[model samples]
Target: MKNSEEFDDSFMDNEKVVLQSIAEDLRTCLPVEAMLPSESLAVEKAQQNCKPTVHVDAFLYDEEAVDLLCEEGKMSRDYCLLCGSHRTAPLGFISHSFSALELRFLFQNVLPDLSGKMLVDVGSRLGAVLYGGCLYSSAAQLVGVEISAEFAKLQRMVMEKYDFTDRIQVIHADICTQTSLLQNADVVVMNNVFEYFLESSEQMRAWHCISQNVRKKGALLVTVPSVQEALAALQGKNGVINIHEWLEELPLDYDVYLGKDTDPESFKQIHLYRVL
Candidate 1:
């Protein structure tokens, strides 16, 4: 990855402004709430009802809108902004920026008070969470583990650009199976990355691997596309576990709770925990 500190403060500020503005525009057009099912039911209610729930259009923003938004910022020419998942045809400028949404959600809940603490960013695609965490907190150490080499390189470039080489390190490794890269962090954050594991076994393996790295009495903040929320919206499976219940199922040595509630429609929830 290449680093360029040559840019003046004004230039950096402008770039930030441009990026933020683009994000804001995309959010306005493609709101997260729209993707959820119209009728909302409690977790228990949906589970007991055992009825399939109706869903709204998952992709609210058309391709044209997404394209226009990206073209203005040079984001249109590249790969997916979120996760670098794949190349989708551009609409106006309403392309899927769920990754951005994920970062913003974390900033609101977990970014504060990170300084002086060691933070491990799990599934650190493009290092968005790593950079956001550093930008928000005065954390003494920042470490990122990403499964994709391309995203790892992007993350390296991003951290270097922000002059975070001294405080942050990015590695290419899978969070589900390998985590020797970070074993002493005070905090570990996994942001909606759990779903990529594909199977329950993989998820459990990944969860165990990451939990082993956190120090006793340290903290773990996680966000998952809430299965409860999804079932609540579709299939009326409200009998499922809520965020608190979901956290309880995790094999951990600490107390966990729903830290912040965001995007109820899409069923995304943030969970915070303190290792005992």
Candidate 2:
């Protein structure tokens, strides 16, 4: 095996191929409308028992390919039964899953070692982080906690299809309810979990809950937006929860993962923190 310092573009290229093959298999059963959580039986069944019946695409880096699989036209609207008023859209109204490249950067650079460790992805929609961990690290266990049952089912289906059941598991429960899981995780990844998916009150409660439960000292906490930025957004807001008390900033040395084709500035938004 090559040392971490010896990693290069050749390794990235090979990993990309493996990742793309998995994505291509998922794309077959995952239509655009089905990308978001849905209660449709057809979509659920298709995802639950998906098989790779077609050849994997040679190039899976194009986000447009995924978008093209979606249903065309405006999304359907919902109305309240009592007052006939419009209600808020579904949980996945906005897509929050990380791109393949971002996942690569995170596992290869931000977290280069995961031997015998357990990783948990909060709000693990579409299981992007979980899949990336399996491919890029030697973590003993990879778990995804998704509140959406539909999304959880999709994740399990994909895992089953890829025969990763030994290392990957998806729990269909809210992250707040899984405090024990959080407490025991060696690495916890929260990718835009609170920004759009949660309400202000829920976000505050979640931060509080996490601070109290995720008490494993020195555990890694990865977030997309820097901790400062996340807190600054709630500076003047009422009922803001301070997470800095429980987490301390950890500087990341990610230069080793950068190459001519990769821009260091692109990852400025990525933040790493350690449990205090």
Candidate 3:
């Protein structure tokens, strides 16, 4: 028991150091918003297509990071209701990636040993999961499929800088076209993948494609906001057939504490599933 505790403590420290380094490198490379031109345009169009809202990509800025930004006068938590008035409305923030903290919780607590397994991250903006997987799990391969060339290039730069090429691969292609990769993956991770990047119609197509291809029995699927929630929004409009036929939701323990600053609610947004 003592040995295991010691190992866990040491590992956590190492993990924090590595993730912090990655975050710093990313901050230096990207702008404060961390939205590439293509991503910003897509978000604009998607917002126009659906409900318009502010989305802060979680990979680049977690709640704590946002707090730091606010402290530094780089970001704000609320906007003024009147230009000169003190009255303000809190900004509704939406995150587009599995945050760094969430990734730690996911790999350390949620997933089983991934040695010799392949994990694919759909719409891996900034390769958060891939880097987390490389550091936190023993997954033999981590693949990220991104439609944006610019995002893909940025991720590749990080991977190369950190020497993650042996296990990490970024494919610059739409996930709707990567059925074969999905078929072979032992684990598939979607962090608002289609919903954030694709139009409602496109998201529908992407989900259907995922459902049909990610059919390897016993394969795991990790998603933010649960797959059910995602499918429900597209039920009548997008023809997202029931996912229950293909997958089963796995309950997660939410009480595990990673830090004093970690938000339990954020962790709850993560859900796990298995191919049935």
- What lDDT does model 2 reach? 0.69
Could you tell which candidate, 1 or 3, scores higher by lDDT? 3
Tens digit of per-residue lDDT, candidate 1, span 41-157: 322233343332221111223334345645767334343445656745332211112343344445554445665787887776545556656555678888888766765776676
The pairs that clash in candidate 2 are: 32-69, 32-70
Clashing pairs in 3: none
Candidates in order, TM-scores: namely: 0.52, 0.72, 0.89
Better of 1 and 2 by TM-score: 2
Best by lDDT: 3
Rank order by lDDT, top first?
3, 2, 1
lDDT of each model, Cα atoms only? 0.48, 0.69, 0.84
Per-residue alpha-carbon lDDT of candidate 2 for residues 221-258, written as tens digits (9 for 90 to 100): 89877766766665445565566677898777656544
Which ten-residue region of model 3 has the weakest summed lDDT? 1-10
For model 3, what is the alpha-carbon lDDT of residue 75? 85
RMSD of 1: 13.4
Residue 132 Cα positional deviation in candidate 3, in Å, after optimal superposition:
0.3
Worst 10 residues of 2 by lDDT: 52-61
Query: How far out, in Å, is residue 146 in model 1?
Result: 0.8
Clashes (candidate 2): 2
